[model samples]
Target: MEDIRIRYYSKTGNTKKIAEYIANELNLKALSIDQNDYNSPCGLLFLGGAPYANIMSSKLREYANNLIKENVKAVALFTTSNWSRRTVRALKKILREKNILVYDEFLYVHMLAVNGAIEKTKLFVKNILEKYKG
Candidate 1:
C-alpha cells in the first residue's frame, strides 16, 4: 500500500489536531503545508485547514491549488470552525474544480480563540475515524 500524506495549515491548531488524528489513523505522516515537500510520492492525500472568517486559510488554499499531482485516487478534506458555516463547502468546491476526488469531508466545531476542548475534539475525531474506517 502506498503511504498516505496528510498536510494542513493552521493558526489556532484546531485543524492541526484533526489532521494529526487522520494521519495517525491512516499511518501517514502529518505535516504542515509550510513544512512539507509536496513532491513526495503518496497514494492518498488529506488536506486540512482552519476556517478563517468563513474562508479557508489563504496559505492552505493556495497550497491545495498549487498541488501538482496528476492522479490522486483519494482525497479527504477537513476544517475547524466556530460555527457550521460554509468553510468545508467552499473547500469542497475548490477541490472539485481542481479535479481532486474528495472521498470524505468533515467540519469540526472549535471554540473561538482557544485551542478548543481536547476531550471534545478527541471524541469528534474518534467519531470521524469510526465513520470513515467502516
Candidate 2:
C-alpha cells in the first residue's frame, strides 16, 4: 500500500510467480522489467529475478544499474532458485553502487516446483511490513 513498485526479470516464470504472489498479496501489480513502468519516486522497489546457471542475467543488471537513489529510497530483493542465492547478492551490489538502501531482510523462496509459494510469499510480505512500515 506504500509507494512500492514490483519489477522482475523471469525467464521461466518461476520468479514471475513469486512476484505475482507478492503483488496479489500486497495489492500491487507485478511488472516485467522490460515494461519500464518505473516513473514516480518510489519508497521501495521490489526487484525479482533468478540466477541463470549460477550467474545473474545482464538484463537484470542493466536495469538495476540505472536505478537512481533520488527515485528509490530502498530495494527489497527477491529471487527463485534451486541452488543459489547469487541473484540477491548481485542485485545488492548494483544497488549499493547507486547508494540505494537495500533491505537487510530479503525474500528467497525455493523454486515453485516444490509448492507453497503463495504461502511463502505471504509470510515474506508480512515480515516486510514489520520491518518497513513505509
Candidate 3:
C-alpha cells in the first residue's frame, strides 16, 4: 500500500462500509478517524465521511486540518451523501489552505442495495488509479 491509509467516520455504517470496500479492494489499511494513532501517512490518504447538513463531520474536518502539520503527499476524499458537493468543497477549502493536493473525490449516495454502492466504489477506484497512474 505504500503508506496509503483509509480513514473514515460513519454515523450509520454506510460510510464505513464504503471505506472498508475501498481499502480491502486496494489492499490498504482502513481505520476510523477516532483511532488514537490516525495520523496522516506519507504516500497517500483516502478520507471518507458521511455528510450532515451539507457539511463534513467534525472529526473529518479536524483531521483534515491536522494534515497541515503532516507530510502527506496527496489526499483523496470519498463521501456518502444524498447529492451534494458542499461537503466536498468545504473540506477542499481546508486542504487547499494547507496547500495539500486533493487528487479526486468519490461520492456514493445511500442506496437500498449494496450492489450499487459497491459498483460505484469500484468505478471510483478505477478512476483514481487511472488518474494517478503515471
Candidate 4:
C-alpha cells in the first residue's frame, strides 16, 4: 500500500489537531502543508485548514493550488469554523477542478467569536474518523 500523507495549515491549531488524529489513526505521516514537499509518493492525501473570517487560510489555498498529484484515490478535507460554508465550498470547488477525488469533507464547530466548544469539536472529529475508517 502506498503511504498516506496528511498535510494541514492551521492558524489556531484546531485543524492541526484533526489532521494529527487522522494521520495517527491511519498510521500515516502528518506534516504541515508548508513544510512538506508534494513530490513524494502519496496514495491518499488529507488536507486541512482552519476557517478564518468566513474563508480558508490563504496559505492553505495557495498550497492546494500548487500541489500536483498523480492518481490520488481519496482526498479528505477538514476545517474548523464558527459557522461558514463559504470556505468549505470554495475548497471543494478547487479540489474538484483539480480532478482530485474527494472522498469526504468535514467541518468542526469552533469557539472563535463564540463560545469555545472544544469537547464538541473533539467528538465530531472522532466521529468523522470512525465513519471514514470504514
86-116: candidate 1 lDDT, tens digit per residue? 6667767777887766655454555462344
Q: Per-residue lDDT of 53-100 in model 4, one digit per residue for the tens?
A: 777777888877766647455566766666665666777788788887
Misplaced by over 4 Å in model 3 are 36-40, 111-115
Query: What is candidate 2's TM-score against the reference?
Result: 0.91
TM-score of 3: 0.84
Residue 85 Cα positional deviation in candidate 4, in Å, after optimal superposition: 3.4
After TM-score superposition, what is the CA distance of residue 106 in candidate 2 from its true location, in Å?
Answer: 1.2
- Give per-residue CA lDDT, model 2, range 1-134, as digits (tens): 66888899999888898898889988999999997655568887889999988987888888888788899877889998997999999889889987899987888888855257777778888887766785
* Residue pairs in clash, model 4: none
Quote the positional error of residue 32 for candidate 3 in Å. Answer: 0.7
Please tell me which predicted candidate would have the highest TM-score against the true structure: 2
Model 4 local distance difference test score: 0.66
Q: What is candidate 4's TM-score against the reference?
A: 0.73
- How should the candidates be ordered by lDDT, best one leading? 2, 3, 4, 1
At residue 53, candidate 3 shows an lDDT of 77
Q: Report, for every candidate in turn, its global Cα lDDT versus the true structure.
A: 0.65, 0.85, 0.74, 0.66
How far is 112's C-alpha from truth in model 4 (Å)?
7.6
Give TM per candidate. 0.72, 0.91, 0.84, 0.73
